[model samples]
Target: MTSATETETETETATDAASRPAPPLIYDGHCHVASTDFIPRQFMEDVAATVHRALEAQGAAPPLARLVDAYAAQHQDHDADALVAEMDAAGVARSVLMVPDFSLRMDCPLTPEEMARRHHEIRLRHPGRFWVFIGADPRHGADGIAAFEHAVTQYGFEGLKLYPPCGYSPSDERLFPYYEICAERGLPVFVHTGPTVRSLDYEPAHPMLIDRAAREFPGVEFILGHGAVTYFDVCADLALHRPNVHLDLGGFAGAALPDGWPTHLNRAFRLGLNHKMIFGTDWPLNRMTGGLTRLVREVTEGTEVFAGVRRREQALILSGNLARLLTRKGNE
Candidate 1:
């Protein structure tokens, strides 16, 4: 019944609304931008050569440099700006950057001070785009805690990152002081809880150890990174029981969901644990586009297949829920 001009005007308005940027609401709760430096040209070349030598051992083609070059072209050597560009393209608004395991390097050693300094610089350059998690090596004893305290006080770090079993186990009494400090200061603790490629004192990176910490320190917020990938059910059980415990869907979110994985996600949803589930891509290792797409698809499919879920619930899992949790209380 509308005139042609009126209809055209309405269409233009709708187009403009659609073109507006999607809510700047995404937060990559776990990532490792600092680890890019570890992937130097020499290291890549060494890995490539090793791959080629192994292949040649089996009478296969020797394409080491070619493969290395391809990966190198896709991602440069320790270029954070390029990472930022990739995040912008993929609609990620912010990333919580964590330091890599220091023990891996025999040379170019990274003490806690050095790690904190780099994080401060990165935060200064990127502002709100990058949030830092101070890395504390329990092996350093008192010195590590002092360094961690400095980072938290000076850099305004939001959380602490621990790679237990990388240098020590979560159950070790030596690390309890650090956990106490975090709890007292009301800072969140993010612990690696999955299969780690690097050599560590412990293997499998089980969530059970972390569960003990959760029970011990109910005040400190604990995030089980990778959603305790190999321990999703255990993580779900923890989330159900512990109000302060949360799960970070970092690298695991990008991978295709297994046959029973959706059930765990649905169980968390049913238990009203949506806000505790955060979105993270573990970028550079997994492209933001691929991670976001997989999350969107899985959440959408889960809602469709499950009885007590809706598409809006999927939106909560992707971004809305995280936005609420990450923001300080009363900000919402």
Candidate 2:
């Protein structure tokens, strides 16, 4: 019943739509793209070879060499274009790039000025695909405040990345000014919570520390990274009760999934704490494919009636929640 001109138009529209890329499943909320100095070349090579062998051992088809080469590029140095290509291969759309500490001590080797420059360049390169988090060392005193301001004002970072108990403590009143500035700008602060190789004491891993900060800075949105690991229940409680608190399953959830991990995830979900969860892989520290596969399997296996809930929740935690949180006040 259609005319020849109408048929031709419809065909062109269908072809155009089909040419679009598939929507990404993963949006890594937290990751680090740092100088290779923090990670030796040999160590990265070993990890790549390990991934290669693991895939081969499973009888999985060999991945494209271009994919492997792109991922390996992340190891040598920070390249925004290479990272974007790797993300595409990994089915990740966006990643929040954070500075890395050589010793996992929260003290960065790069000066604030250098960090600002790099942040600007990365934003220029990737645009919406990459977001910046400013690293602040309270030990720098007034200089630290200046650096933080520069990162926000000049570099246009949306959040602050802190490793409390590594460089300072949540209870330290000296860091109040930094917190105040974040609250004023409505910047989110993601604090590293969970066991860290750098921590000699366990106090830093406690969820209670974040609880206090949430109470003190009601204006600032606080993200407790790694979900306080051994203190997941406590973190969940805080997230459920506090108006300004959320948690990210970065390394903790992935590391916990192999044995009886579904039980913990189910418990967290049943507690009505699903809205507070976000996805992260602690890149250069964890692999995206492995982490995502584990999450999908564990969540899907954990429920029967909630199968749809599981899928929706995974999508929310993996990307939607992050999009909402990051774009709360036009930071998107």
Instruction: Give the CA lDDT, 0 to 100, for residue 114 in model 2.
Output: 77
Which runs of model 2 end up more than 4 angstroms from their true locations?
1-25, 37-74, 100-109, 198-201, 252-254, 257-263, 288-312
What's each prediction's TM-score?
Answer: 0.76, 0.73
For residue 24, model 2's alpha carbon misses the true position, in angstroms, by: 6.4
Cα displacement (Å) at residue 206, model 1? 0.7
Clashes of 1: 0
**Candidate 2 backbone collisions, by pair:** none
Which candidate leads the pack in TM-score? Answer: 1
Model 1 CA deviation exceeding 4 Å by range? 1-24, 38-79, 104-109, 201-204, 253-272, 288-316, 319-332
Candidate 2 residues 1-332, lDDT tens each?
99999999999999999997555367787877644533334434444565677688888836646445655565664665555765765667788887532234434445556766876787887777888877776777797788788788887888888766455676467677878988888788888776654223457657677777789889888888888345777888889899889888676454555445455555555666667887776765644455444443444334631344556776677688788778877787
Worst 10 residues of 2 by lDDT: 100-109
Which residue pairs does candidate 1 place in steric collision? none
